[model samples]
Target: MSFRKRSEVVNTRGPGLQNARGPTQDSIQNARGIPANTRGMPVNARSPVPARGPQLNTSRGRNVPSLNNNNPSFRGRLSQRMSNMNINDDSNSHLNNHPGIRPSPATSQLTTSTGCNDLDSLLGHMGLPLGNSLLIEEIGTTDFNSVLCKLFASQGIIHNRLKNGNSQQESNTHVIVLSLNKMWGKELPGTYKGSKKDIKKQNIANEQSKISVSNLNEQSSTPSRYKDLKIAWRYGLKDEIGQKNSKSTNQDSTEYKDYNHQFDITSRLIPTPTSDEITYIPTNIPVSSILTQLTNAIDKNPTKLIRIIIPSLMHPSMYSPNYFKLTEIIPLLHGIKSIIKQNESRCVLLASCFTNLLQSSISSSKLLLNQIQSIFDSIVLLEPFQQEMIQLLEKSYKTQPNKIQHGLIHILKLPAFSEKGEMCVSRSEYAFRNGRKNFEIEEWGIPVEDVEEDENKDNNVDSSASNIGNPNNKPKKSTKVDLEF
Candidate 1:
């Protein structure tokens, strides 16, 4: 075979049978010129590039290129934009400085006190929010729920008095009581003052302190001239210090007026509310007339905070048997609810019902109660202690009278109008004591003595049985000999 370089090899085939070769400069130039340039210019000639059309922005039409090129962190730019925006949107403008209303510690919504600090705490909001209704259902015939209604009414009147401060003009808080009782104003509780014994103890303590100071002064001997000279200066210093302390204490007390006040059930509201501050509506009237009157009250006091108190709801004394019909009661309540919703910032409703009166055997009565409870934003069921439970409590708290509980409080449902939509029903058993000075709610628990007795009994039995296992313990020998088999 003849040795020949692959590059110089020639084929004897037709002219089309050529070997593949690398691109030459002339071939590359021809390939580049194949596409016609309508501008009729040389490829290498410099020409002004046509201005680019607006780019199709896929990122919601944002300037993504600039954003990405300038700052890699999008969150930083977002924070900068947020910093320049107004944070106070003022959606709750009506909540600002409204009398008798305070922002809830839990939800931060505008709320008013229910006149009982413990009851307020039980509601989980620390107070009752405006535009919502609270239905208190009691099982017994005792009128303990009526006491709460009075407190609710009195709180409104007191708030009105405090707001206007001796002004004869109409008050800013209006209390509308749905009852025919003319002496309702006189029945409201007054602010609590400590018992005589407590006051006496305080006075005695003060006297003792003064006596000790006087003794200390007497024990020290000083020159008469110096003593006389320093007495005025010392008094002057004391007076200055006292004035400063008083100013500080006064400032602290006035910093935020208490949202709830402690009331004494034994005393009546002094200088009862004026006619302008409270309105009594008759519940015996037709439901339509009641709705009309409610509407008129709301309309008349457009600028005031109205507190509606419906005490003893569905009681035979307050309402006729015909009023119990679902058609009549439902529309009445729905109307009141609508009014509250319309003036959410300035209205609140509190009503009490007797669950014992509702016949469970009758489906309609049971349904009526359920529907009424559903209408309210919150439902609290109060079950009074039975005779047996009462005896136990009395015996347990014989020495500590103040610790005795009168009834059990069941939080069936709490208001769910907050932005978080949180609904909480307290599962833990809670006991309530309706005291003369306050209505207290506390965690329910068995007495310590009872628990101790139970533990002692178990321990005694265990100790006796455990002695059998002890190696140190000896068993008694039988006196009589066993019979021989």
Candidate 2:
């Protein structure tokens, strides 16, 4: 805020002299020796002149601070103070204060839930990676796969409304549902609280383990005779130490364990009055316009996370099967891919398409899907069981009364940037069942009957023959029985 005054040049010479060298006007007048052509003006008007400001001054063309002057150090110190400040830190803090906005995950953990806890773990990252797109391919006409989409949207809504420890609600994240269908928001899946039966079973299992350990300790410590009192004391002491260790471990697991959330499809996840987390965009709008709108929505809350759900994308019922052709779908998905990469910290994209529609024309579908899959960071295919696969499942889980909805979770692509080896990949079948509460997923064992394929084939052949009856043997005599009215 302070300004330094310019150094004044003192004119100490006599009036007739100009700085002890050049002739003054009085000297010129007295001499009468100046020519009219060059009397009042210098020869070159463009010549450089000394600066009149308080900045560094030099006799040569450029200003160089004199080494004797201490002012240069003061200027250097001022610049150093400015450089030490972080502009990003100030801008980030300002953006974070906007209601419903969140800071980018660049410095924090870059993961969010895929909504389904089981699916999240399966995807790796134990949640969806921020700024990546996930493609879900559901085989056949069954829209059961759409349930995953709903859970994704519902989970986002729940995450957006969560309040911090200080009881202040942060800016909610936005969910945009892009689809051709109109049934989106009507039946969004509700939040899932874990089942009471499952919780009780886990508790019971933990109790049983504790009992078995206690019994083993008791058997090992039993004394053969009262003479071994010292040995008995030692055994008792070991038993007590082992019990304490087990109890401490159990306590730790109970206190710090994190659980996956399951959502109910019977109801919807209602948004708060102040924030509308879900926005349904109709596919009728041009894709260009859709992108524009999406850009605007993201700009509205640049600091917050955004979840984009494109349900039943390119479904034949919604759009013609030909639309999935490379000429069309590729460019569209490419645009989306660019957007995802550009705003990676704040946005995530999820798209689903019925795998059956793509398979209608095998070669083209395969080619198209392969290309489309390349655009996404993760790709998952849910294939319903083949007849043989179904039979094997039935034979394996027959003892268990609960009907297991059978499907193969073909992980076409694992979660983003996972470097895990194929040996570590999970081949566990995705077993799920719809209940009053919500859909639940569990790791299903590979059917044991797989090793007995030949045996199963023989059994199937015999059953077919019995059902068809003997073709070679002659006809049986019909017994005519009369029924009285």
Candidate 3:
């Protein structure tokens, strides 16, 4: 009986003891796994975790704000600095009100007229862009390029007159001529009046209109008067006529401040510009001194658009032989470029040079010419027709003298101030004629005589082809007999 009782005592702690012992062992193991720093913490408590930096949203994949905002990183600081700086503030706003300046048709950059509409068109931007320089080079000794310079100067004067409106105190444009010519103002060309034919037609029309008006009073009661006054309502002619009248009025209002104007080369500009409007710089001075004078002129007229015309650049009569050296001329041009870039919104430069003066066959001379051209934003080369070529053109255009071209114009470079900086340097088939009323540039074609000769050759070819199948037009038999085969 004692042995049976000892076996039954072990069975009391089977399921319940095991369940309680399992939890106690787990608690001890967890306590041992924790570090010494967290030994006294509650069993169910968690350790503190550090806050994270900026993160991307999982759903949208966009940047999320940083948890800490006290000290921003370098990138954040840089972004803040950039947003504070406004570089182009009001730079172009002032240019909009300038009467001489207008938006370029191709690039929308503010452009000023070259005084010659045809020359402006040749620049490819419809006008010379502000802050640009144009270099006109003539191959011969002829002073044809001077006409363009005068036109340019005249345009500036006209624009200044329009902008100031009889107020001599305030000037809108300042023309600085680097020459000793004191009577430069007197040489500027005049605005073109209508040609003789056009004037005659206008006078005849005026007289006819007056006659018709006087006759209208007598015919007012006649049925024919009513018939003449009848409106073409079926074709909406009344609306078209009204629109045309309104358009004419609008054109008249805007024509006074036209960007380009027709000029008569034979006549002088009326009401020549005052001394205050134009300044002549003595070219006999040192190049540095000349630059200083230009800078001073620009500084004095800060509010006005400055047109710097350096006519006959490095001419023996205008500039000393020392000034023709590369060391001297390069710095002068560089200084001018610097000025233009500094006052990029308000300044333009135009210079003309005779290439024959610089012997381009030599490397040094060629290098000098290239350097000069490189400084300018646009370069045009004038090759006047030779005497024989002129004679040929005269002969071909005997019936229409105006159609003959005096010279060929080559565009070496185009103005490139736009955002795209696009430029074209190609052999353009363009010819220019200095007309009485206007400087004309047109597409060049062969002479009419050559065209006629080509036509005759084509006719000969046609006749030869026609004779291919004709018996009467066949080739004649050989006079000498061929060798026996």
Candidate 4:
């Protein structure tokens, strides 16, 4: 309210210039050398200068000190209240109001959006909808890395969707996945990046290409900065009531439809993710690593869904830390079974054991019989021969190693067990070319076998007089009935 006086205004005391009109034309004429009116008046007065009028309510008006100058007196009050309570700039306050940009629905984790749907179905909602940590199990493939990407990306998706406002959609959802298995190159969508994905989406500025969960090469600190499912769901649901839905959906749902029906694949996990960001593990992944992942998931949330897939080619030794002892692995698997039955979340498991390792390794006796069956949502056992196969394997290893080699490395070209169903490379062939690294298709399918060679010679010998009483065989019903001495 108070204004400081400048020296000229306060101290000037020029005799002729004292404000009674400093030297008008008449006075100027009297002055001896008054430069002949210099065209007639002081330049400023003749120009478009403003005239003095009503003085503003400030100290400058009176050039005097008073209580009202700095502070209002008790008797005097403000004539008009402050017009508006506002500052000249607002950028800082706006940012302060929203401390976080991408607020997670739960725990306030930050995340980007992924533009795909095929990836989100298996993983819960985007932004990782809290509550349960998914224990993913890949089946019929090496796309586990891709699946995990989607899993992590779901966190981003859920985060943005639930809390970021539905009108300004998310462009990409990035997933941070840990992989113990080398993933197929084609699994990740070719155009994978940060903001680049945002441009790919149409219209929705926030749409960050549907879930590009980052793939960290090195594991970061333990407390992952992400939201759990419940919070993610709330965030993802925010604008979804009226926003555009994702274009991509499950492409391979059918493959897993059979998986759900036959291979113990999770109902929600069906139609595995075909696109997403991921890190791939490339060597013979130790079975220990897979168990560790499941254990970690369990440690985080025992009630979350769990899934597992194992290749038939894995040898007993591949499960080394536990010494490939079916005994040890079977117990662990049995434990999973008990847990699944007791929880709200689901558990699904798949393996070539349906052919190579089932009875031999998974169920040597009746011990794990019920536990193994109940643990998996469904079990697709594809033994080419419906009858017992170990006897046939024993015969092949003996009579004709050539037949074993011919049926496997040659005719079938897949080195699995004698069931003649699973045709995967055996892990023991570590010394061979490429060894037991990424999955190799050369070990699965074979051209239909010639009936003569494919027949169970062991059964044939047993059916004939030569095999009637072998220890592995039993007496015929006719023999027991015809004992009418």
**Collision count for each candidate, in order:** 0, 4, 0, 56
Model 1: per-residue lDDT, tens digit, 1-485? 86887445345454344434433333443333443333476667654555578856676865544555356577687888999998863424433555568777677877888898788878777678988899998987777898889989888887777733354544568899888887878889998868999888778656645757665675465432343344466865666678888987565235546567889999999898877888888988888888889889878876778899999888888788777788888998998899899888889999998888876424588788888887899988888888998888887887798998888888877875422465566643998899998988899997755676778799678777777877877544446685767
Question: Which pairs, if any, clash in model 2?
Answer: 100-171, 100-172, 101-171, 192-262
Instruction: Write down the RMSD of all candidates, one decimal each.
Output: 14.4, 18.0, 12.7, 30.2
Please tell me which predicted candidate would have the highest lDDT against the true structure: 3
Model 4 poorest 10 in a row by lDDT: 431-440
Stretches of candidate 4 exceeding 4 Å from the true structure: 1-293, 298-317, 321-326, 341-343, 346-354, 357-371, 374-377, 383-485
What's the distance in Å from true for residue 202, model 1? 9.0
Instruction: Supply the global lDDT for candidate 4.
Output: 0.33
- Alpha carbon lDDT at 354, candidate 3: 93
Candidate 3 lDDT by residue in tens digits, 261-285:
8889999988888877999899898
Better of 1 and 2 by TM-score: 1
Query: What local distance difference test score does each model get?
Result: 0.77, 0.66, 0.80, 0.33
lDDT, candidate 1, equals: 0.77
lDDT of 1 at 396: 81
lDDT of 4 by residue, 189-249 (tens): 2222224454554434344333444423212422222322355656545545334333234
Lowest summed lDDT window (length 10), candidate 3: 23-32
Each model's TM-score? 0.64, 0.58, 0.66, 0.24
Where model 3 places Cα greater than 4 Å from the true spot, the runs are 1-94, 163-170, 196-257, 360-363, 417-423, 450-485
Give the per-residue Cα lDDT of candidate 4 at 217: 21
